[model samples]
Target: MQSRGRYHRTVLLVLVRTVWIAVCAAVLVVSGIAWSTVSTISNGVERSFAIPEDAPRSSSGRNILIMGLTTRLDLHGEPLPDDVLRRMQAGESDRGGYNANTLILLHIPASGPAIAMSVPRDNLVPLSSGGEGKIKEAYGRAKVAEEERLQAAGQHDKRTLERAGREAGRRAQVQTVATFLNQPIDHLVEISLIGFFHIAEGLGGVDVCLKNATKDPLSGADFPAGRQHLDAGQSLSFVRQRHGLPNGDLDRTKRQQAFLSAVARRLKGADVSAMQAMIDMAKQDVVLDSRFDLADFARNVPTEVRFETLPVEGGARVDGLDVNKVDPEKVRKKVTELAKEPPPPPSNDGIPCID
Candidate 1:
């Protein structure tokens, strides 16, 4: 009887040892899976862009140009209005020339909420020509120059127009705008109304609060006073409406900033399902400049970043059109102060190209 009891005890001890081994193996498997998941995400983000080997590493600081283009093509093959299409085809609109709807310069310091300053399309600046014109006209002038060059080269009308459009799109517009910003722009990202709307919808929606009831017939936006959740279309109209606002473009600029802030806030709190939706939306809606690495940048966006508009008094009529302009000297001084870095002594340094 004693021998049988001892044998039973030994078997129980063996069973416990076997269970311990199985638990350790299960833990190892789970740990391996977790490590693999993290590594895969990191690699996917890093490989999204072909960054230059010699590109300056971000010094805990970043500066980006956020341009809102005025194009009307939808990501999912929807067509724009016939008149809008005609304007684009005729090179009279949607070409990023005299009709650039929105221009914003965003500066992200090594630490802080990003500062965005709008350059009134009407601010007069020295053009490549000795004469001066509205800031909005600079790109148009460049487009005209490219067209002239193509004509001089004896290109056919259609070919000349195409080449001119490409050249105009690739020129130094961003850099010129950067000069107006009074600092070097480290990166640039352009988004259209359609793209913005798609992104907002993909994230479910964004909340916007207005102090008073507002309506804009042209933009098709109507909002009652108080907090409300805006869908994709409403959000677009909210940011794009200029008329009826007390301050016009200035007020619109503030609204744009607010919208972007809300979007960023939503993204920060997004769950896995929301992130997947965003990724899918980007695959369809985004057409980035070749230099942008969206995945990497998306993953690295700082949570503590703040958002503010550039200092500007208001809007005024320039050259028969209402436009916004930045005081060059004032902008320079403000940027220097905000950067907390002394401005370099005045020199006639030429502007850099947007590579």
Candidate 2:
């Protein structure tokens, strides 16, 4: 009887071990599937952009320009109404022109965290052509000129508008921002204003923290202190508000950086099941330059990337508009500092947008 009991006990132990092994194997398979799905969704959203294959490999690393086009061609190829266009052309009050309100330059070093620099839209800089204007105006002017030419040639208005918008996006803005970088910018990513809102909504909104109370009628943003979860419309207004910010454009640029950081954090936290939500968001309101391949890149971007903003001083104004003029000597020095192998820690505070 004792021998039989021992045999039965041993058999039961073996069975339990086998079951545990099977459970572990199943768990692993499910985890892998989930990870893959998340990666695919993220890449799909980003793949619309055109990333150059032969982009120069940097020993120190490469830079990417994340441009937000102010044109009405968000994901749906929608154009602004004629009345709105007329008001914008006449420089009427409250009419935001077709110009890039946000410009961010991302410097990804071969090693360490990525640095993001924001350029204020009102920055006064000499254009490639003689004379100075708001940096945002360059692309808008190019777009307007292209449309006028197409109209004069008696082309189909819709088709011509589409072509003109594309040309304006590629030639006027992206190229101009690259030129301003004064360094070899390897990749360019353009995201429309609507794209940002859709992405936020898709992710179930983003949490934003304001150090103080703020209100801006122009951007329709109103917030009172502390952490607040913002939906799509609120998120857009939060990042767009500039009038009430104490530092004007400088403060707005900082808010944008904070918002992007929050977004990156939120995306990293999303589970594999959220893939559908991501895909829906991309399909609805996102467009990318033709070079990026979402599937491939998504697999490689581990959730450990670091984010930093570009440093700038707010001391100048042009034509009553606040401008964060790039300190050439400071920028050159900073760039050189970044070129060193295993780049140094990012300087905290005083970073602005690259637009």
Candidate 3:
């Protein structure tokens, strides 16, 4: 996603989700003076996909699902160039196989606190049908099965098949997560890995702090423990590094949240033109369903938007794969508490920086 590199690892597809909302808020702030920029981003806001017509919506708010996928396929379902593929690390895996590496459900209410609930990638959950599997695999499996079914039914165009297949996969993913959490998923935003890198670059870089020096070849993360600015590649590495951290992916989740807060700080001070450029660059990487207007919705959004992990019980093995386990009741309890929370504290910023 950061221009100057050989394309070789898709894991760097660190799609920082919270920034999208923050940037929307920023753009809205600059809309009066930056009409041209606002107009440009608004033009690309065309509805490109469908959500359930009968999807449940709360009178108080809506639940938006944001998914970070592992595949490098573009919106239309075609594979990207090898160099792009390699940089995104999509080349590490076969095409057409997409995993929801990051699954976050953001609850925006008309009143009270907003919740950014994160569902662990390796959580064990029931598939859309029956039986259990790593929740992340739901999309990939459904996509593959759908593609096969469509192919047999005589749909032969590669692009057409891929598109249809991905849609099935996305629906299954949304339904599965919604059912598991007992929440209605009202909308979605999908980000490609390459898009993630460019997005960070456009926004400048996120400020991050580490508790200790760390390095990881798998994710290509190397940093000294302290406060430092992270460019696109480094930002990707910071949130993408899982192996070296004490809590593994759980830690990376924090990195993601911290990055979002950093984004909020960055956007808060950016000039209109800078913010506009960031939005323009980001538009190239993000895919949305139903063209939800963040600026319009931002009006009713709770002043307190905070991120929290879905309460997890512990780790458990499902079908031989390690997974996070959660009690449904506990999750509901947390959601309830989140809904009643007061204005979010400034500490909404991520992991503490070690001086």
Question: Which candidate has the highest TM-score of all?
Answer: 3
Deviation in Å, model 2, residue 279 alpha carbon: 2.2
Better of 2 and 3 by TM-score: 3
TM-score leaderboard ranking:
3, 2, 1
Alpha-carbon shift of residue 263 in model 1 (angstroms):
1.4
| Per-model CA lDDT versus the true structure | 0.50, 0.53, 0.66
Worst 10 residues of 1 by lDDT: 22-31
Which 10-residue window in model 3 sums to the lowest lDDT? 5-14
Candidate 3 ranges beyond 4 A from true positions: 1-19, 22-50, 81-96, 271-276, 302-304, 342-351
Top lDDT: which candidate number? 3
Model 2, position 106: C-alpha lDDT score? 60
Native-referenced Cα lDDT, model 3: 0.66
Clash pairs, model 1 backbone: 113-306, 114-306, 120-324
- Give the per-residue lDDT of model 3 (tens digit) for 1-355: 3321111101011112322543321122211122333344545643436477777765657888888777666666666767654554324435525888888888877666567777888877889956888888888898889889988998999988877777887788888988888888778877756665665666777787777999888888889988899887777777677888888888887777676666766755554454455555556666667646544553344444567888788887766778898787787777767756723555534436631
lDDT per residue for candidate 1 within 96-183, as digits (tens), equals: 3333456665555554344445655556666543366666565556756776777788875765464454336424455466566656
State the lDDT at 188 in candidate 2: 58
TM-scores of all predicted structures: 0.65, 0.71, 0.83
List the candidates ranked by lDDT, beginning with the highest: 3, 2, 1
Per-residue lDDT value at 128 in model 2: 41
